[model samples]
Target: MWPAVGLTRSLYLKELYVARSRWRSGVGTVLMRTLFEVAAKHECSRVEWTTDANNPGAQRFYADLAFQQLPSKLFFRADATAIEHGLG
Candidate 1:
């Protein structure tokens, strides 16, 4: 998780992954709950993450945890080469 600049100090979760064999277990829930606990400890305003649209399981998991989908926003990636080229 990376902290955002501002009074609220929001956090952005880069990614979350669990072993395929661990599916249907409570590990994901526990992991998320722990992440929230950490965010609370740091007084973070919110925690954000992104999942591929192709991964319905992940999407459902986040939705079950009350994470709203921001369909209006789009996620972009800038690799090292792209950045080095100053967004060409």
Candidate 2:
């Protein structure tokens, strides 16, 4: 679900999904367009989302909608280095 707020120039799509059998049947397009329209109604000038790096299908889907790939950053935290040294 996407969050709805007062009219703004930015839009964010938290998540979207379609049935596997319905791929390329215009459902995804319609869903995106509808979302865009909703965003536009709220004065949103941009729509954005994130997908897993290994999800080629999702990547292609977003690409078809004119979404350009942007550089990303990831961070991880680890602790207790000795905790796993002797334990399997």
Candidate 3:
């Protein structure tokens, strides 16, 4: 994750996943706790991450960990053709 600046200046958790067989076994909790510890060690104020809007499971998992949901728009620029025109 990048050391980002601006609002919510903290470590970003880009991705996190547990094997299907490990669900509900506390592995994710342990991993998240460790991640938070590392963030704190690095003097980060918090951790940030995102999941697909349709992913209720992930939403629930994050909710259980007391992670709040922020309303934000995610934009994408798929412009391979524009790249050729130096506009990407």
Candidate 4:
């Protein structure tokens, strides 16, 4: 997700998924490197993303990539009406 905040543009990597068969094959590394390159080209000051708290592998991967983990909470308030309206 790319969002303009004041005068700066930011990059948010909402998801990065590789097929299980491709894990440990360096595909994720290459992809992340490419993402950084793209972010740089776009002059993005920060790249943000989130992972499940239970997903240790994802946490380690982001940590290895030098991403700092911030304390945060994921919240949702979706009712049946919201779901029906596709706003959930």
Candidate 5:
């Protein structure tokens, strides 16, 4: 869970399980709206988050909430391969 910083900016989602009965209750939409309202109350200019490249469902969810794609790429590198073996 992401912690909310008072009177600042914070963005995150309320996790929902992939259960058929739960989906029928429309809880996801409610949760998203609540999050947006909380951020807005804090005077947040923007809310941001990332989803896996292959997660079309997640992409669609964010898009529906008016999130745009940022023009940047994220890169990752590590020096140590195995700490126990002292190899990097």
Candidate 6:
């Protein structure tokens, strides 16, 4: 969870992966619902996450769950190894 513009906080879901054996078993939906419940219990204003652009199945899953795409935002990451040595 992170601080937001207002008094509310937001939940950042870094990752959510279900095992291949659990696919099409409604596990993802249940997990997402539980996540939302936990977030609401903690007073989180919203939940933000990212899905691979190449994974259409995952994208469709999120879209089916009513998660909007923040097209304007780009995700960034700093590899732990690279972070120690500054990029050359």
lDDT of each: 0.86, 0.79, 0.82, 0.82, 0.63, 0.89
C-alpha-based local distance difference test score of model 6: 0.89
Checking candidate 3 for backbone clashes, the offending pairs are none
**Which is the leading candidate under lDDT?**
6
Evaluate model 1: give its lDDT: 0.86
Off by over 4 Å in 6: none
Task: For candidate 3, write residues 1-88 as lDDT tens digits.
Answer: 4445654348777789899999999999999999989988887766777888899999999999988898774635557887778853
Q: Identify the leading candidate in terms of TM-score.
A: 6
Better of 2 and 3 by lDDT: 3
Q: Which is better, 1 or 2, measured by TM-score?
A: 1
Q: How would you encode candidate 2's per-residue C-alpha lDDT over 13-65 as one tens digit per residue?
A: 87889999999899999999999899778777677777888999999998988
User: How much does candidate 5 score in TM-score?
Assistant: 0.53
Model 3 stretches with alpha carbons more than 4 Å out: 1-9, 73-88
Task: Residues 1-88, candidate 1: write the lDDT tens digits.
Answer: 3446565777778888899999879899999999899989998988888999899999999889888899897998888988888943
User: In candidate 4, which residue pairs clash?
Assistant: none
User: What 10-residue stretch in candidate 1 is worst by lDDT?
Assistant: 1-10
> For model 6, how does the per-residue alpha-carbon lDDT over 1-88 read when each residue is reduced to its tens digit?
5677587889888899999999889999999999999889999988888988899999999989887788898988889888999988
Which segments of candidate 5 are over 4 A away from where they belong? 1-21, 73-88
Model 4 over residues 1-88: C-alpha lDDT tens digits? 4456666778878789999999888899999999889989989987767888799998888888787787674645688987889942
Sort by TM-score, best first: 6, 1, 3, 4, 2, 5
Once superposed on the true structure, which residue ranges of model 2 sit more than 4 Å away at CA?
A: 1-9, 72-88
- The lowest-lDDT stretch of 10 consecutive residues in candidate 2 is 1-10
State the displacement of the C-alpha of residue 27, model 6, in Å, after optimal TM-score superposition.
0.7
Q: What number of backbone clashes does candidate 1 have, counting pairs of residues 3 or more apart or in separate chains?
A: 0
Sequence-dependent TM-score of model 2: 0.68
